[model samples]
Target chain A: MNRQIHLVERPKAAPTHEHFNLVETSIPKLGDQEVLIHNLYLSVDPYMRGRMSDAKSYVPPFKLNEKLVGGVVGEVVESNSDQFQTGDVVTGMLGWEEYSIAPEKEIRKVNPELAPVTTSLGILGLTGLTAYFGLIDICQPKEGETVVVSGAAGAVGSVVGQIAKIKGARVVGIAGSDEKIDYIKNELGFDEAINYKTTENIQEALEKACPNGVDAYFDNVGGEISDAVLNLLNKFARIAQCGAISSYNKVDDQGPRIQTKLIKSSALIKGFIVSDYAERFKEGAEQLGQWLQQGKLKYEETITEGFENIPDAFLGLFEGNNLGKQLVKIGEPQHAKL
Target chain B: MNRQIHLVERPKAAPTHEHFNLVETSIPKLGDQEVLIHNLYLSVDPYMRGRMSDAKSYVPPFKLNEKLVGGVVGEVVESNSDQFQTGDVVTGMLGWEEYSIAPEKEIRKVNPELAPVTTSLGILGLTGLTAYFGLIDICQPKEGETVVVSGAAGAVGSVVGQIAKIKGARVVGIAGSDEKIDYIKNELGFDEAINYKTTENIQEALEKACPNGVDAYFDNVGGEISDAVLNLLNKFARIAQCGAISSYNKVDDQGPRIQTKLIKSSALIKGFIVSDYAERFKEGAEQLGQWLQQGKLKYEETITEGFENIPDAFLGLFEGNNLGKQLVKIGEPQHAKL
Candidate 1:
C-alpha cells in the first residue's frame, strides 16, 4: 500500500488540513516507457497556493480529490524504458504518494557526485533557475547598482541576493523574521536586511538601506513591501515580479496606484515564471553550478521528515516558517546505494 | 508690451482660475545666440499637470509667480545667431507668452510647406512621436493581436490606435464619451471602442469587444479603466504607461494591487515620457512625417483662440473636453509667411 496526499477541497483563503486528505492506495503500475519511482524527497512551494484555486493561471488548478503533483526526487524501483534504468536516482514532477509512475521523458537522472540530490529540487533546479533568469534576464543589475529582494531568506530570494552580489551590486533583503535577517545579512553577505514584521516603517527602512535608490528589484513577496520598494526606484529601474506570495491567500488585496510612480521614474516591471526560460535551463543550471563550485554561491534547505507532514510544510511557507528551500524527506531509496 | 501667463499658485486638487495669473509685461529681448520668437501656437498637455505641483518628477515642478513654459510654434522675429534668421517659423520649448526669447540650440525650424506650421505643435511633433515610440518600441503589438488604447480620442491615444491598425493589429479604444467612441471607431478605424462613461460594466464591455485577450495596452489614462484592462491581459502582454490623468489630481489614489495579475499573465509594464526617447526622436519624427504625407495617419486640433484662454485650454484637458490635441492659438507669425 502507498500513502498519498490529495486535494479534497478547493481553498478560498489560507489552506488548512480540511482542504487535503491522506489516502492509502495500491502503488501505481508502470506502463511502456514508464518507471516506478520510490519517492525520497517531496518539494513544497508558495506557488502551489495559486494552483489550489480554480482560477485561470499559467498552469491549471489542482483537481479536487486528485493526488497533488509537484517536484519530487526519487529512485527508480522498476523500469520499462531505455531512457531510465532501475535504481537510477532522478528528479521530475511526480505525485505526493510514496511511489510514483512517470514516463521516461518526464524524469531526468540526477548525478549525486556533483552535489546533494536535494539540490536538484533547489539550487541546481527550478528554484535556482528562477532566481537566475528573473534577475539576470529581467532586472539586469549593473555593478555598483542596488538590488533589493523581498522574501530574502526563502528558496528563490536567497539565491537572487547572492547572484546580485556576485554581479557587484549592493544587495538589500527584506524578510519576516530576525533569524532570516541575520542569515541574509551575515551569512549570505547581503548589504542590508529588513525584518518586515518588526520594522515599524518599511518604506523608511528601505529608503535608509537603499540610499542610492533601487536599480533592480526581485519581488517574491509583493504587497505593501513592493509599494515601498517602488517608491524608492531610481531612473530606468527594472523589477522582476517573480512572485506575489503576500497576496496569494488574499481575496481583495489593494494598494496605492503605481502608474504615476512608474511614469515618474521611467521604470520597467516584468512578471515571469521559470518555464518562460525553458530553452535556456541548461545554460542557467551550468552557471549556477559553477558559482556553487567556486564558493561564490550557497544554499540552505529546511527538511521536514515524514510524508504525513507535507501539508504542514507547505502551509508553513505562508507563515514564513522555513529558512530556505522547504522540502519533506520521505523514505530513502530501497534499491539504490548512496 | 507682451502678455504672459504665470503659475501663481499650485492647487492641492484640480487647478482653477485662481492658480494662474495673466499679466502685461515688456517683450523679452534676444541676447547673443538667441532669437526673439512671436508665439503662434502653444500646446496644452496632460503631463503639464504633473509639473504644476512641487513634487520630484522627471522634470522640475513649475515655479510659482514665474511664466509657464511649454511646446510653442512661433516665428523668429529677431535673430542673433547663425542657426536662425528673421521670418523662420520654428518650434521649441518656449514660455506661454506672446513674445519670448530662446537660445538658438533650443529651437528648430518647422517647414510650413511640408504641412501646416501648426502640425509642429500637433501630429508632426511631440504628440505624434509620443504615440509612435510608446506603441512601437514599448508595446510592439503583433499582427492580429488585440491592442487597447486608453484616452483614445485624445492626441497621443488617437495616433496610437491608428499606428496599431497600421501594424495589422486589432485596435480597441477606451474613451469617456459616446461622440469620442464614434470618432475612434468610425473615423480612426479602431476595431472597437468602449465609452467608459456610458458603459455600466467596462470589464464586461471589454470582454465582449475583445474576444481575444488584450496583448498590448497603450495606457494614457490610468485608474479603474486600467484596472479593468489589466484583468483581461493575455500571456506576455505589454503595457506602455504613458499617463495617469485620472489620478494626477487625486492626493491619495488607490486601487487593486496588480502584481499578482502581472505575474499570472507574465506581462510587462513600462512607464515613460516622450523625452526619454529623445535620442531616437529624429527616427520617430521622420516615420510620422511619411505616414502623415501618405495620408495613412490623421490628426485633429481643438484650438482655443487668444493668449488669455491658454489657461482654460490647459484646464479643459482634465475634463476631457478636447477631441484631439489641445492647443491655444496665442498669435500668428508676425514676420514669417504662412
Candidate 2:
C-alpha cells in the first residue's frame, strides 16, 4: 500500500501538523529506468520552510495538494532497470511517503557496507556539502583567522566550525542551550562557545570571545546576533551567510540592521545557495565523508521515530531542538534488525 | 611671506567662515632635498569632512589650530634638491596655505604644459585614481553588465561612468541636479541618467533603467540613494563603496542602513579608501593620464579664486554647489607672468 502525507494548505505563521494530510492507496507499477522503493529515513531542514511559502525565492515554492518532497534514503522493493534490483539500497529526493516510484536520475545507489543509509541523508549528503562550500568556498577561512558560527549546534553550522578549526582557525560557536554549547565546545573542539539564550549582551560577548574582532563569520541564524558581530568585525572581514533561521519565521518587520557597519568596517558580505555549487557536489561529499572517517569531522543527527512525526522533527529546528542534522527514521533495515 | 589657514574650532553642523583663521609668517626655510612650493591650487573632498570631526577614523582627525592637510598643486620658488628645480610645477599632500615646503618623497613633479597643474588636484590625481580602482579593481565590471553609479557627476563619479562605458557596460548615473545629469549623459556618454532630486521612487527608477538589475554598483553617495539601489542588485552583484559623500557631514545618529541587503542578495560590498591602493598609484596615474591625452576621458574643475576661499570651496561640496571637482586657486603660479 502507498501511504503519504500531502500538503493540504500553505502555512501562515507556524505550520501545524493538521496542514498535512495522510493518504493511503495501492502501490503503483514501475516503468523503464524506474525503481519502487520503501522509505527508510527522511531529512528535514530550515530552508525547506522558505520553499513552502508562495514567494519568489532561490527555489520554487511547494505546491498545494501534493506530497511534500525532501531528501530521503530507501530500499528498492522492485526495479525494472539494470541500475537497481529489488532489495538494493538507494537515496534521493523522495517524499513523506511509505513507498515511492522514481526514475534512475532521482536515486543514488547507497552502499550499506561503506556507510549507513541514514548517513546519506546527513553528513555524506546535502547537509555536509552545504557546510563545505559555505565555509571553504564562501568564507575562505585561512590559518590563524578567527571564525564565528551562529547556530553552531545545527547540521551545517556544526560542520562549518570544525572545518574552520581544521584549517587552523580559532573557532567560536553560539547556540541556544548550555548543553548544545558544551557539545560543540568540548566534543566538537570549538575554541569557545556561547549560550545566546543566557547571554544578555551579544556584542559584549562577541567582544569578549573574539578579542581581535571576527575575521570570518559563518551566519546560520541571522538577526540581532549578526548585527552585534558585524559591529565587532575587523577591517576587511568576510561574512559567509548560509541561512537565516532566526529571521526565516518573521522576515519583514525586524531583520537586524547590519548595513551601516558594512561601510564603516569595510567588510565583505556574500550570500550563496549551495545548489549553485551543484557541479562540485560529488567532490564536496567525498571530502566531507573522508574527514568524517578520519575523525577530523563529526556529525550528530537528531532522529525522530515514526513517519508521522516529520512535522515535529522539522519544527524542532526553529525551536533549536535539534543537536545537529535533523531527520525522521521511517523503518528499521534488515542489517539493523539482524 | 607665507600665509597659512588654521582650523580653529570644529563645526557642530555646517562650518562657518569663523572656523578658519588666516595668519601671516615669514617663508619657512627649506631643508636639504626640500622644495619651497608656492601653493597654486587646493582640493576639497568628502573624506576631508570626516577628518574635521574628533571621531576615530581610518586616518587621524584634523587637530585644532593646525593646517588642514590635503592634495595641493603648486610651483617651486626655491629648491634645496636636484629632484625639482625652481619654477618646476608639483603636486602632493600639502597644507592649506599660500606657500608650503615638502620633502622629495612627499610630492610628485607635474608637467604643466601637458595638462594644467590644477588637474593634478582633479582628474589626473587622487579623484581619478579613486574612480579607477573603485570601478576597475573592486567592482570588476564586465562587458554588457548594467552598472549604476551614484554621485555620477562628481569628480570620481564622472570618471567612473566614462570607464564603465569604456569597459562596455550600460552605465546609469544618479546625481543631485538635472544639469549634472545632462552633463553625464551628453558629455560623458552614460547610457542613462537620473536626477535624484526630481525622482520620487528611486527603486522603481532603478528597475526601469536596469531591467536586468544592476550587475555592478559603484557607490559614491552612501545614504538613502544607496539603500534604494541595494534592492535592485542581481545575484553576484559587486559594490565598490568609494565614498559616502551624502552623509559625510552628518553625525552617527542619522546614518543609513543598507548592509542587510548585502546579506539577503548575496552581494559583495567592499569599502575602499584610495590610500589602501597606493602601491598601484603610478600605474593608475599613468593610465589616467593616457586616457586624458587620447581625449577618451574629460574633466571639469570648479576653481574658487584665492587661498582665503578654501573653506568656502570645501563647504560648497557638502551643499552640492560645485559642478565637478572642487578646488581653490591658492596663489598665482611662479611663472604665471612668463
Candidate 3:
C-alpha cells in the first residue's frame, strides 16, 4: 500500500492542508523499461502553486485525483531496464507516495559520494540552475556593482547572492524576517540585508544600502519589494525575473506602475524559467559543485520527516517558515554511502 | 530679435497650448567656438512632454521662462569656428527661436546633397536611429514571426514596422484613428492594422491580427495598448519599449499583472533612449540612409507652417493628429537641395 497526496481542490489564495488529500493506494506493477522508485524525498516549491490552479501557465494544472508530482530523490526497488538497476540512487519528477513508478528515460542516476542524495534536491537541482542562469546570463553582474535579490534566504536567492559575491559584486538581500536577515548577512556573508517585514520603509533602507544604485537585481519575490528595488535601479541596469512568490497566492495584483521606472533609467527586465537553459544544466551544475567544494557556497535544507507532513511542508513555504530549501524526507535509504 | 516659446507651468494632466508662453527677445552674441544657426525646422516630439514637468527623468525638465530646446535643423548664418562655415546645413539642440547660437562641437553638419535638410530631424536623425536599434538590436524580429508596433504611424513606430517587414516578419500596427489605420496598412505596407480607439476589445483585436502570436513588439504607447500587446506575446517574445505617450498625461496606473505573463513565456522587455547606442550612431545612420536610397523605406512628414505654431504642434502630439514625423518648418531653406 502507498500513501499519496492528491490536489483535491484548487485554492483561491494561500492553500491550506485541506486542499491536498492524503489517500492510500496499492503500488502497481512496472511496465517494460520501468523502474519502481521508493521516493525518499519530495521538494515543495512556490512554483507548484501556479500548477494548482486551472489557469493557463508555464506548467499544467495538477489533476484533482492524481498524486501531486515534484522533484524527488529515490532508491530503486525494482528495475526492468538496462539503464537503471535495483538499489540505485536516482532523482526524477516522482510523486509524494512512499513508492513512485517512473519510466527508464525519466530518471537520472545521482552519485551519493559526490554529495548527500538530498543535495540533489537543492544546491545541484532546478533551484540552483535557476539562480545560476538568471543571475549570470540575464543580469551579467559586474564587479563592484550592487546586486539586490528579493527572497534572499530562499532556495534560489541564497545561491544567487553567493554567485553575485563570487563575481565581486556588492550583494544586498531583501527578506521577510529578522532571522532571514541574520542568516543572509551572518551566514551567507551578504554585504547588506533588509527585513521587509519590520522595515518601515524598504525604499529608504535600500537607498542607504545601495548608495551607488542597484546595477543588477535578481527578482524572486515580486510585489512592493520589487517596486522598491526597481525605483533604485541605475542606468543600463538589468533585472533577472525568476518568480513572484509574494503574489503566487494573492488574487489581486498589488504593485505600482513599473514602466516609467524602467524607462527612466533605460533598464531591462527579462523573465525566464530554468528549463529555458536546459542545454546548459551540466555547465551550471559543475560550477555550482565547484563553488560548494571551494567553500564559496553553502546550503541549508528544512526537512519534514514523514509523508503525512508533505502538505504542511508545502503550506509552510508561503508562511516563510523554512530557512532554505523545503523538502520532506519520506523514506530511509535502502543503503547508505559515505 | 528672436521669437521663443517657454514652458510657463507644468500641467496636472494633458498639457494645453496656454502652458507655453511665446515672447520676443534679442539674439545673444556667440562666444569662441560658436556657430549662429538660423532655425529652419524644429522637431515636435512626445519626449518633450517629459521635459515639461519638474520630475526627475532621462532628460531634465524645461526651465521656466527659458527657451525650450529640442532637435532643430538650420543653416549656418554665422560661424565663429573654423570647423563650420557660413551656409553649411547643420543640426543641433537649439531653441524655438529663429536664430540660436551653439558651440561648434554642439552641432553636427548635415549634407543637403545626401538627402533633404528636413530629414536631419526625421528618418535620418534621432527618430530613425531609435527605430533602427530598438527593432533590429533589441527585439531582433525574425522572418515569418509576428511583429506588432503600438503608435504604428508615428515618427519612430512607422520605421519600426517597416523594418520588421524588411526582416520578413508579419507586421501588425495599432494606432488611434481610421486615417492612421489606412495610412499604416495601405501606404506603410503593414500586414495588419488596428484602430484602438474604435476597437471594442483591443486584446481580441490583437489576437486576431497576430494569430501566430507576437514574436516582437515595438512599444511606443505604453498604457492599455501595451497591456493588450503584452498579453499576446509568444514564447521568448522581445519588446523594445521606446515611449509611453499613452501614460504621459494619466494620473493613475492601469494594467494587470505582467510578471506572470512574462515569466510564463520567458519574455524580454527593454526600455531605452536612442542615445544609449550613441557609439553606433554612424552605423545606424549609414544603414538608414542606404535603405532610403534603395527605396526599401518610405517616409512622410506632417509639417506645421510657421514658428508661432511650434507650441501647438508640440501639444498636438498627444492628440494623435499627425502622421509620421511632425516638424515645424519655421523658415524657408536658405537654398533648396537637389
Q: C-alpha displacement of A4 in model 2, angstroms?
A: 4.1
RMSD of each: 1.0, 3.0, 1.6
Which lDDT tens digits does candidate 3 get at residues B62-125?
8988889999999888889999988888998888889889999999999888888888899999
Candidate 1 pairs with clashing backbones: none
lDDT of 2 by residue, A107-128 (tens): 9888878776778888888888
Restricting to chain A, the TM-score for each candidate equals 0.99, 0.96, 0.98
Give the best candidate by lDDT.
Answer: 1
Ranking by DockQ: 1, 3, 2
Q: DockQ scores for all the models shown?
A: 0.90, 0.35, 0.63
Task: In angstroms, give how far residue B22 of model 3 lies from its true place.
Answer: 1.6
Q: Which candidate is the best by TM-score?
A: 1
lDDT of 1 by residue, B92-164 (tens): 9999999889999999999878899988988889999999999999999899999999999999999999999
Stretches of candidate 3 above 4 Å error?
A336-338, B334-338
Model 3, residue B314: distance off in Å is: 1.1
Candidates' C-alpha lDDT: 0.94, 0.83, 0.90
TM-score of chain A of 1: 0.99
Chain B TM-score for each model? 0.98, 0.95, 0.97
DockQ score of the complex predicted as candidate 2 = 0.35
